[model samples]
Target: MALDTAKKSQIIAKFARKSGDTGSTEVQIALLTARISELTEHLKINKKDFSSRLGLLKLVGQRKRLLRYLKATKYDTYAKVVSELGLRDK
Candidate 1:
């Protein structure tokens, strides 16, 4: 269950820093978060979906790395993204 193009576009538009910033850290984290949420729901319905669970773990790892990089390089944008996404303990 992948995100549709329209929803993906919405996330990109919300997190994009510039006009064509699809691959920026914030956009990437948002996209990954969306996918992770979708997979989480799927896992809740299909409890035996181990492959989807593994994929969810991978997506979470990727998002974590991206967030780490953003926090190290741009704290303000990272904070904004975290707040917008409601991520982390903060």
Candidate 2:
């Protein structure tokens, strides 16, 4: 599934402007969350798709790294992103 281009661009723009800007954390998390959700739905439809599964794992790893970075650099931003994206308890 394709991402919402406008929204994805907005996140990339924000991150580009300021790497440490916490304002974009929610957007980043939201985009990743959406991707994860989409991949999950696809997996349900094609249970034998190993390539997609690998991609999903890679995305999850990337998201986890971003989350860890946010947590280490700015705990508040990490918490806010986590809450907004409902990514906890996973």
Number of the top lDDT candidate:
1
Error of 1 at 89 (Å): 3.3
lDDT of each: 0.91, 0.75
Model 1 C-alpha lDDT per residue in residues 1-90, reported as the tens digit of each score: 889999999999888888889999889999999999899999999999999999999999999999999999999999999999988743
Q: Estimate each model's TM-score.
A: 0.95, 0.74
Tens digit of per-residue lDDT, candidate 2, span 1-90:
667878667656544436555356555666777788899999999999999999899889888887888798998877866875667834
Clashing pairs in 1: none
Q: RMSD for all candidates, in order, please.
A: 1.0, 4.0
Number of colliding residue pairs in each model: 0, 0
Off by over 4 Å in 1: none
Score residue 27 of candidate 2 by CA lDDT.
Answer: 56
